[model samples]
Target: MNYYSFLLKNAFEDFKRNKTRTILASLGITIGVFSVVMLIALGIGLKNYIRQQFENMGSNLVMIMPGNDLSEGGFSSFGSSLATGIRFDERDLNTISRVDNIDYVVPIFMKSMVVTSLEKEELASLMGTNEDLFKLMDLKAVEGRILEGQDISSRSKDVVLGISIAEKLFDDAGNAIGKTVRLGNQRFKVIGVVEKMGDPEMDGGIFMSYKTTFGSINPDKNFFTIYVGVDSEGAIEGVKSDIEEALLKRYEEDEFSVSEQSELLDVVNQIFGMINSVLVAIGSISLIVGGIGIMNIMYANVTERTKEIGIRRAIGATKKDILVQFVAESVLLSGLGGIMGLVASALIVLVVRPFFPVALNFLAVFAAIGISSFIGVFFGVFPARRAANLTPIEAIRYE
Candidate 1:
């Protein structure tokens, strides 16, 4: 057999002979790789899920929210805006409606409140918009009809519900229609239950007319957001500029933001990017600990094989040969752990994908194996050098 092949055979024999030590040595890397891969998969899945929901809203959709919502970091800006009492009023909405190349305009007032039915009560997101919201969102009712033009015009106390709120309150989605539910301090009759959209605000919210909210729940008549539909995808940039130009006349530049659906998706990606970086940093700690474990196990192996090392050195084996054999064993052990971690991670993703959006990435697979091999070389060198330095007389004399 070739000298290199013989060295590898010895390494494999070592693993087979000390099964417990091999498993213990590899466990650290296995856990580290599994953690890193799973975290990355979860991040990728969340980004994909959010992107899908945005795509469903169509390319022509534009949004105007209070303050620099996207600029201040996604979701975190909401509390600041509310604290400062900055919001869009009817004047801004009217100005946006007159902008050229725009389609429907829907002003929205959103708040979280308790919604109660005869059977149960739950905390729900409440949205006050007009009939135009349905047109802009392309939302359909599964039970009855959504808010109508008459409902908005006459300030009718009719409400549309998300499917989750419907089931939670009425015991079933189909039973929600024609029922009365208390919204804030007033009772509004449920006119429709909309099909389940993936967004939390849409899936578990209460929808009512902005006019209905006025003089009751929302006395100030301030809106949290405004939704706009452009006549064409090409006209989106123009509409965004026009809306900003209009709102800038009534409020400061920092007081509000105008963005499109795609921009919102970008913000979501940016947030996830930061989150994944943190996860990687945390997972690297596990890999380092695992590498240390490998190093310690390799040192113990060298100690146990001192007599065998002396026998080989006294015969024909060179120091380089002794070094290569130990290093090969270390690398093999780490490689096995990396492969085991990948298999375990893949199995977990497969199981979770049916209920959630988790997916295994090929990049993660290559990176994990590459990192494991590098760890093997880095941690194995000291022990390999120690084993090679043993003089035949001294190693043979040791007990």
Candidate 2:
């Protein structure tokens, strides 16, 4: 047989002869690759899901939030509220509404509280907004009707139940409407139930008039966020600048931030990008440990084959031949492990993707396998050289 083919055959024979060592060595790499693949898939899936949610809100959507600096706007600040005591008030909302090229101006208030129905009680978010919120969000009720101008103007105690709360409270959509639910100490009559939005935050929630929220639940707190819909996508930049200029003129310092949907999406991408990198780095730690395992196993293999090495070297075999053979075995072992990991990861993704928003990441898969091969080569070097350097006389005489 050809020398190269004979060396390849020896690699396979080594694995078959020492199944326990081969399996144990390969197991580490399998685990490492699986972790990396799964983590990256999860991160990508969540990022895509979040992006889709924002896109569903509409391309022309703009958000305003209270910030210490004009550029430091954020979505939530449970702790910062106590520290800064800075929040958007009705005056700020009115000022934003006065900006030209704006379609709807709505203030948003979100609070987590216990909601009790006739037969059950559960935790839910109480979202307070004006009647225009429904139009801006493009939300519709599955039954009954949404709030109107009168509801906001009169500060009516009417409430809208999200699908999740409706099901948990009243058992069905039809039975939810016109039901009275207790939010904290106050009672709110459910006038409508919104369709299943699929967003966890908005789905299992209660929608109430902003005036009622401010007047009753949080009399001391002001609005913290505002939603503004520009009349056209083209005019978004112009309107954003105009709002910033107006707010800057009103406040001595940059007390608030104005951001468009596209800009927010960019920020989301950057955050997820960092998170993915960190996750990959964490997962790669396992790969390094696995490489160490491969190295240890390779060293042991060289020890066991000392006699075999002497027999070959005493005949016509060269040091380079022994070196190549050992290296090939190491590469084969790790390559097989990487392939198994890919299969395992693919199976896991199949099982999870149905329940989650995960997608197959081809680049991550390739990188994991490539890294495994490199690990095999890197860790196999010392062992391969040790086997090659054993003199025929010494190796043959060794007990």
Candidate 3:
């Protein structure tokens, strides 16, 4: 028979001779592999979940909110501002659009008032913007169409209802499209209804032309929020920096703040990395416990097979053969456990995927297998060597 076949036969026989002990050793390895796999899968799932949440906000979109500038002795914070003079207007939006690496720039004005229908009345936030707002913010109307340039130029008294507001004012999604809603005692026809935005605050607001809303509500402030989109993924940081510099130069003060999509994603990834590290550290303790169990079982097996070792030594079996047999037994036990653990982990991920999106890392599986096999070899060495070195007479005399 070939060496491979001979080794397999001997390992199987040895396993059969000590079924309970072999099973106990394999259980330890199974637990270790299972812990490591589960921990890794959970970590990846959490990271993906956070990423999806951030993506739901918008892609390659950044908002520059107003802030006050607070400068100490001489050092300036990278993007810090504590002055209250960072009011944005249509002119700022136009200036930002002319900067290099900018895809689109949108200016927003907001106000809160009571919106009333004939049947019911509700409080809602009113947002005003130009036609480019749709493209810059990646917003789409689910029921009807968005506002046009003519609507802004003519200061039309038309309104777009958000999904939640539509539901509250009108009976159904379709009915809300053409119904008239009163905003702050002013009657405006609902020309469109936005799709369900995920955010409760945004879903409770109404969208209108910037000229109309500003003219009707607060026209003198000229204070608004700006949304800027970079030309490409690679240009996000550079574009943000250029916009900040331009604003500082124009305003003659560092009173503006800038945000980038990549910066937000980096913060999210860092938080997830810390969480994953803590989880892996806890899982590693289980692996150490499992390794210790493997060593204990191996020592017990050596004591039980004392007479067997003596009988084999009295025959033609060499010390090398004895050592090889014990080591092979250790590896077979751990290797089988690792395979079973991988299958079980996959099954678990499949079952939980419907409730939570779980991402499996194939690299983590291979690493677990390698570690388990290495543990078998490292822990099995001392016991196997002790058994191989036992003299025939001494082992035979052993009870």
Candidate 4:
């Protein structure tokens, strides 16, 4: 074997002789890396889930929200507009509806509250919109029927339950139809159950007529956001321009934003980026613990191999050689553990992907390898230095 390979092989043989110590040391890194990989995968899956939701909502959609929600990087709120921005009203929708190339316009009123059924009370996202919402989103009724224009015109307190919310509150989608559910202080009859759209925000939402919603928490008839579906992707730019011109008549430039689907997706990406960074920090706590274990094991190896170190020294092996050998062994243990963790986590994400969106990416792989090496070097230093500093005569006489 070449010099470095010999060093590695020697470390391997020592591990084979003390399998338990090696496994335990490696196990520390394994668990730590597992945490890191799984967390990053969760972040990636969340972004994917959001993108799917956007796609399901249809293409070339335009949205106007109460904020300068778009960043300089193309769109997402600077966070100031949603807090204190002017909300849109029905007049705003009317003005935007006259915009050429717009196929459908729906004002969105969102409220989060507990909806109670005879079976249970569950928190639900209530989406208030017109019948045109069903058309633009291409939502289908899995049971009963969706809202009709008559429902909005009459301000009827009829609701369409998304599949997840219906099941949670009534124990079955079939049982939810014609059932009475209380939202805030108003009781509404469930008129339909919408099919699962593979998005939690849609699947778990309770859809209601905007007219009826104005009677509940939205008494002033103002909306948080407005959705406009254009006829074609080619029409998106024109539609956005038309929308801005229409709304500018009543609102200031900074008080609102008109966004295309792609801009909203950019915002989603930024959000996931921040969230993943946090997850990595949290997961690294485990990596630090694993590093400590590796450090402890290396210290023990130095004690056990004192005489061997002394004999190599007497045979003209330098202190740097002894240090490098022990450090190599520690790094080998850490790297093996990291690889094992990565493989195990990949298998887990694959198996769980059908139900959850967890994904494995190249960034996660590179990160695992890089972090593992860093931990190996960081934790291996002190123990390797102690071994290197051992006096030849003292180490030889060590019993």
Candidate 5:
């Protein structure tokens, strides 16, 4: 057989001879690999979950809020001087809708009022929006229908209760729909109930027709918040710019802000990237410990095989041959440990998937294995060289 094959055969035999030690060493590597792999999987899963949550809110929707400039000392000074006087009216909406790449535009007006059902009453924040608002913002009715165009044209008092509001006032899901609810002494029929959109305590808000809210209830409140949707993903930035330009031209002020879904997603992804980096750094510590374990075991092996090294030197084995054999053994041990660690990592991902979101990335697995094997070689070199360099007389004399 070839010299390399002979070294490999002897290495295998030595590994098999000390099964317990081999298993113990492999266990250490397995633990390290498992931790690193699991952390990566968890980070990926969390990133995806956050992305999905944002997507559910609306993928293409952008929210524009009044920005306050510290230098100017007011919300109006931050954007355009006209923004201070300009209430987002139908004229503004019409102008924005005419902008190229804009698919839909809707304005929102909010009011805090006491809403009373036949059985009970509660204070809630009511939002007024148009039909396009439902489509643009992913607002859907779980029980009944959303506000219609007729509700806006005729100034109807129809309202859609938030999931939390529906649960608190109504006995069941079905009962909440078609029930009459009084909003700040103004009676309106509840046409729909929003589905439980998770943590309603945080985002629980009611919806109503824009005309009824702005034209009838509070004609004095002229200003409103606007939501705009771009026709396509590629057009989002252009649409935002066009809208800002149009608004600036009309009102002669740049007092508005535009947000894109892609920008929001990028922020979310950056957070996830940071989390993964931190986790990977933490997991690297285990690898260092495993490498130390390898170095220690290789040193011990050198001491125990002193006589064997002397014999090999006596039998026409060159220093290079001896070096290659010992180094091969160390590499073999570490490579085996890495393989086991990779297998354990896969099992860990599978086991923990039900409890937490985990996705097995083959690239990560291969990377872990490669890194562990490299560590083994790096730490194993010194001891392997010491064994190969031992003088035949000195090694033969060693007990």
Candidate 6:
């Protein structure tokens, strides 16, 4: 047989001769690759989902949130729940409105209030916002008219209900309009029921005019967040810079953050990036363990085949031939293990895709295979070198 045929024949025989050890080693690789594949897929899928939601909200919207650190271009306004930052007020809203590129600026004040609809009562988010916010968010009332400028100017006690909130509060979602709902001891006539948004934050909201709710609750209280709409897509960056510059005049540093869709997407991507890194590190631990397993089994193979090595050397087999044969055996086993791991990862993705969004990561698959190939060679080197260095007489004498 040719040298390549001889090497292939010996490698296949070695794998068959040690079935249990080979399977165990391959299993380690399978588990490691599976972890890497699933975790990365999860991160990518979540990032895409969040980005899509934000894009749906509006491409030209810039969000202003209260925070001192503007290093990352923006801080997630959702972080305000920790009560760690200052709040913006009406003066800030007026100041932002005057910025050249800004088309609309709506202040948002959030509070947890007890809302009662006849006999039903639930604790829900009470949003103090103006009619401009409805247009900014692209929200349409399904049953009745949304809050109008007249409601804000008149300081009318009128409320808008999200579809989910309306269903929960009234007998039927359509029936919610024209009904009276109590917000913290004040009765407000429900004038609108917003269309189903499929967002937990907006879907569960109970909205009223900002001036009305804020004036009644506490006129001095500041807003939690502000949404700004720019006139043109090209003007977002200018608006962001103008906002930062305006805020810097009042506070020693930038006490507020200005962010557009791209900046927010960047923040989400960064967060998911860190999460993916942590997950990848965790998965890589298994790969390291698998590599160690490969090493141990290869060493054992050398010990078991000492007499065979001695016979090969005695029959004019070069040191290089002995080394190549051992290395080939280890590489073949590892390659098979990697292929099995890829199949297992693909199966896992299919099974979980319905429950969790997991994109097929072709790059991760290729990387995993490459890493596996490297692991095989790396762990096989020491044992192969040992087999090559063995003297014929010494190997033959070994029991």
In candidate 1, stretches whose alpha carbon ends up further than 4 angstroms from where it belongs are: 1-5, 69-79, 82-85
- Error (Å) of candidate 3 at residue 82 is 13
What lDDT tens digits, residue by residue, belong to model 4 across residues 278-343? 998989899989999999999999999999999989999899999889889889999999998998
- TM-score per candidate: 0.93, 0.92, 0.66, 0.85, 0.67, 0.81
Residue pairs that clash (backbone atoms under 3 angstroms), model 2: none
Each candidate's lDDT (Cα)?
0.87, 0.85, 0.77, 0.89, 0.75, 0.82
lDDT by residue (231-342, candidate 3, tens digit) is: 6878877887788787887775445667765565675677677877888778767766777787788888889889988998898678998888888777777887777777
Q: Say which prediction, candidate 3 or candidate 5, comes out ahead on lDDT.
A: 3
Candidates ranked by lDDT: 4, 1, 2, 6, 3, 5
State candidate 4's TM-score: 0.85
Best by lDDT: 4
Compared with the true structure, what per-residue lDDT tens digits does model 2 show for residues 1-399? Answer: 998789778988988999998999999999999899989999999998898789667669988766543235443442364347467778888888899999999888888999999889989999888888888878999989888999997989999888898888899978988889998789999999988766888889899888899766878657778889999989998998888888887764445667788777877787789999999999999999999999999999999999999999999789998888898888888888888888998998899987788877999999999999998888988899999999988888766
Off by over 4 Å in 5: 1-9, 16-20, 54-60, 65-101, 106-133, 137-142, 147-226, 232-235, 246-256, 351-357
Candidate order (TM-score): 1, 2, 4, 6, 5, 3
What lDDT would candidate 1 get against the real structure?
Answer: 0.87
Candidate 1 residue-wise lDDT, 241-315, digit = tens: 988888888888878888888778777888898998899789879988999999999999999999899998999
Clashing pairs counted in every model: 0, 0, 7, 4, 4, 0
Worst 10 residues of 6 by lDDT: 69-78
Total residue pair clashes for candidate 2:
0
Q: Model 4 lDDT vs. the true structure?
A: 0.89
Q: For each candidate in turn, give its C-alpha RMSD to the true structure in angstroms.
A: 2.2, 2.5, 6.5, 3.3, 6.8, 3.8
lDDT of 6: 0.82
Model 4 weakest lDDT span, ten residues long? 71-80
Higher-scoring candidate on lDDT, 5 or 6: 6
